[model samples]
Target: MKIAGRTFVVSGGASGLGQACVEEICRNGGNAAVFDLNEEKGAAVIAKLPSGAGKFFVCDVVETDSIAAAVKQTMEWVQETGKPLGGVIPAAGVGNPTTILDRNGDAFSMDTFDFVVNINLRGTIDLVRQCLVHLAKTEPVGADQERGVVIMVASVAAFDGQKGQISYAASKGAVASMTLPMTRDLARYGIRCVTIAPGIFESGMTAVMPEKLFKGLAAVMEFPRRAGQPQEFAQLVRQVIENGMLNGTVIRLDGGLRMPSKI
Candidate 1:
């Protein structure tokens, strides 16, 4: 589970939490296959990494063929770099604030609900499965015969779904709920599964929130009353990868923030 000399597949690696993870991995002497749709941002991220430490692949996680193609390209890059696939991080997600009934009392848009679910829930699972296809076949690396790890990103909203977060909460909750079962399914292959449920992190999803709402979220923090740095999230990701005992569970990266029902 060592980060050094290994390659990790990271979705949404072009920015925010995923970008921090990519930087952290490169700093620790590992390689990252960054799967993202933004070519410019992807290239910028790769440019900052150590030479040969990162590569970007254009991938839209909602598309099955896109993920397959990215995985193929990643393996080929892995071969070139001589780094074994060590982990997978499916961090690409989106959020939409929509109530069951609109301001005019109209029913919720099914299209909006579907779009959120498809990206946040289905997209994450698909990326992990696609990467696991190859990760399972890799040679086991340590005394535990561990092949790789999966670090999924969830949100505190999964547990504390305030008003207008039905779709977002459902998608993230499913991710947290699937951790144990997915781990069990992959255990024999020496692949571990764990999910991270973060609260009020400085991610793309939070950046667009109104100033008042953002401040309200900060007020809920028990200490260091502020948004979490992306690096802090990245630190936990590294810990999960190196610690063999962290499997089959969802770890909260929140700073003691359970999130109020109104926030």
Candidate 2:
């Protein structure tokens, strides 16, 4: 609902859409803490904002220990200010393409496949569980406002999982699949769960693609014919928070373009 005075934890807040969301939150007078591996960028982001209980913590979200530590630090801060840790954004994720035809297809280097699933799926679940624990300590708002809100970032690959996207698809698809069940499980406590499934956007993935390739991809966006902006996605996040009724939804932020199987 009202962004001001709320406290939020944004994972992967060092850059990209997570960074934009953090900025938007601070701009709206809400306090925030970033949990990410990029300590340099995370610290810089915190410094640039108008400081008011906002800070950063280094975390390899794939590890339960790290997630628990993050929640510990965040709860400590919230307790200092007597504000509830209102919600979380598990926007930390990685993507790579590997064809099923490759000899390594089934042999997905435990290094890569495990890393992806651990960070994308397990990290998300870890945060949700921790949030529930902390939310239980807070009081729910009488009306539409929730005790907490969880917004996860899933890729369009989860939907159009291309031929070479075995691991990536499975990982993100898990996020897509869990949105509703999570909402239902958390409803009695006044907690809301939502997912953001972005299409080809100007994320780190597109940043590495060649200009020609990027342009070719952009030309195919279902409506805008261009990659959506981080701010656009953040705006939708704000909308989700305000429209309390919009829960258990995995919004496709890709301007109508279904991924052609990211491989």
Candidate 3:
């Protein structure tokens, strides 16, 4: 799928990996509807891009109304402009520390557990459904009639979620697990689906970690000895959009760092 002049919807594009993806796509002459809850950061990201190449949509991925509205707005924008809706990048996610066993050693708060799943897992599904509806409208003018491309961001924790990461890991793991079947299901629609498992990225839960802990984490990697840059993750997103053959596989963008049984 050629990216230039294409329109891609990037959820959580206000900062971190999503923001980088929006910038990267814009650089390739693609337009992006950057979906994020942070209006200020979303505007900031939009400001950094070429005028009219991108715009920000304020949205909370967990809400059905918000997701639907964002999708409607994006589709409307494309229809008015006569641009094909490229695809969706569901990057909005949340992580909160809550042990399966609380201080009293009882079951963890179901509320907390539900929060993670709702934002990370179900949110992706919501966007996937909305994206497919739009992607189906794209008619291939040439040999490449690719309707759309969907990229899901998961964590290496899905493979080895450490202690206290039960919720976070489980949510991320759900995203990873859905890749293969999602690809198969969406394939018939001319839509490609791929999952990216980033071991230790420079954002999300890891970004706020103390320097000492971050360094200790770097030491655990098999090579590269560092957390992945958001740009690196964005680069892979670009590859998924450009390389039509890559589909239905979860690529571990981690620097060979397998997380330990903590965090």
Candidate 4:
């Protein structure tokens, strides 16, 4: 399906990779509804877009009510703009570095694991399912009878869990695992699902990492020897939306980076 004249719902669109996707969509003549908790950042992102090209809704992906409300508002905005709901991209996630046991041999906190999974895995699924309720109702756009697409964000850690990344990896790994089955389940509705497994990139999550650790991670990249830029990730997101056959798969956007057990 074409992006122009259609609206896409993007969670975490106020910053990092999500923000870049919003910018790319608007630049290509599509509208983006940015769902994020940070009003200041969300407003900033919307301000940079062309008038009527973007809208910001304060949403917490972990809350069912918040997602329901955002989806409702997004459909209302779509009606006002005369733009059909084209797709959903759940890019909001979090990573916590916690081992199964602490140095003193204490068991890991179940609370911490639950928190990470709730945001990264459950939140992703909740957003997609909520948006699908509206997206599946839209008229099919092309000869292929396509309604919309879903692009979820995973991480290289899903494949290669490093030290102290148990919760993070488990959450991301679940997301990767859901791609194919979810796509199959949505096929009857003319909706497609895909996942992007990104390597170490410049994001809010990584920006706080110590310099030594960041550089160590970047060093593993085979080519260019650096972290990915948010724009590069956004470009892939656009291509996946335009390419009809990119369904039920996980495409890694890392620069030939096969992460080792230790970063």
Candidate 5:
């Protein structure tokens, strides 16, 4: 599917990887709707793009009503503008590190586990489910008869989770696993599903890590020996959208870094 003149909704588009997707989309002649809770950051991101190339919506992925409303508003905007709904990227997530047992030997809090699953896994599922409604309505654009694409953000932790990453790993693993089934389920609609399992990316969340810890993580990379860039992630997202045959798979953007167990 060609991205030019199309519209895409990006959850968590205010910063980090999502921000990169929005910027890339706008630069390539497509418009984007940024669904994020951070109004100030979202506005700032939209301001940098051409007028009408981006819109910001205060959406909390954890809430079905919030995402539904955002989708509704986006659909209305697309209807008025005649731009087809091209894709959706669920990139909002949290990674609060917590061990199963603390130094004092206390069990992990169920609340934390629930919070991570709800936000990372459930939130992503709900957003896609809601958006698929509108995406299904779009006419196929390319010879492959593709209507839209859904790009989910998983993490390398899903495969090689470190200590204190049980909740995060489970959530991301679920996301990655869903790619194949989701593709099968949505194939009839000509909508594709794919997951991106990124390794150590220099996102806002990782920017605050101690230098020693950062260096240790970087050392694991075989080449470049550094964190992945947001633009790299965005580039893959674009490729997945344009490539008709890319579907129902998990693509790793890790630079050959396999995480070691953290004690």
Candidate 6:
């Protein structure tokens, strides 16, 4: 599908990789809805875009009411701008480090594990289901017969999970595993699904890390010897939307970095 004059909803668009997507969409002549809970940050992101290029919606992915309200607002925008909902990117997630056992060998907190799974896996599914409702209503765009696209953010942990990543890996693994089946299920409606399993990238989550720890993480990269940039992620998002044949697959955005057993 063409990026210009189209609309996309980006979860977690208030910061990090999602913010980059909102910026890139506007820069490429498309409009975006910044779906996030942080009103202040979301407004800031929208403010930087061209007027009418994007808007912010207060949304919590794990809450049904929040997501429903945001979708309603987005549909209103679609009507106002006369642009079809062409894509969605689910980039909201948490990565709190946890192990199955503590120093004293006590079992890990089940609450923490549940929280991670609920936000990362269940939240992503909810957002996609809601977006698909609107996307399916729109007519297909271009000769590719594409009604919309969904790009989910998985992680390298889904494959090469290390110590303290059990919950996070399980959540991301589900996201990656659903790509092909989601594509097949949505085939009749012409909506494509793809996943991006990113490696160590410079994001809000990583920004607070100490210099020594951050450098040590980047040291494992096989080439370029640095963390991936947010723009690079956004670039791939744009490419997937433009390239119709990229459906039903997971693309690893890591720089040839196979994470070790522990951090």
Top candidate by lDDT: 4
Least lDDT summed over 10 consecutive residues: which range in candidate 4? Answer: 254-263
RMSD to the hidden true structure, all candidates: 0.8, 2.0, 1.5, 0.8, 1.0, 1.0
Candidate 1, residue 253: the lDDT equals 80
* Reference-based TM-score, model 2: 0.93
Candidate 2 shows a clash count of 1
Please, what are the lDDT tens digits per residue for candidate 1 over residues 1-263? 99998999999999999999999999999999999989999999999999989999999999999999999999999988889999899999888888999889899989989998999999999999989989998999889999999999999988998888999999999999989999999999999999999988887778899888888989989988999999999999999999998899998888888788785
Better candidate by lDDT, 1 or 4? 4
Measured on C-alpha atoms, candidate 3 has an lDDT of: 0.86
Off by over 4 Å in 1: none
Residue 97: error of model 1 in Å? 1.2
lDDT of candidate 2 over 1-263, digit per residue (tens): 66777788898888888888898888887888898999999998899999674789888888888888988988889888766677888888787766645674465466777777888999888977886788766777757546878889998888887665778889999999999999999898788899999887776666886687568767778789998888898898888766788899999888888656332
Which candidate do you rate higher for TM-score, 3 or 6? 6
Off by over 4 Å in 4: none
On the 0 to 100 scale, the lDDT of residue 214 in model 6 is 69
- In Å, residue 57's CA in model 2 sits off its true spot by 0.8
Q: What lDDT is obtained when candidate 1 is compared to the true structure?
A: 0.92
Better of 1 and 2 by TM-score: 1
Pairs in clash, predicted candidate 3: none
Q: Write the per-residue lDDT of candidate 4 for residues 237-263, one digit (tens) a residue.
A: 999999999899999988888887775
Model 4 residue 184 lDDT score: 95
In the predicted model 6, the residue pairs found to clash are none
Give candidate 2 misplaced runs (Cα > 4 Å).
103-107, 210-213, 261-263
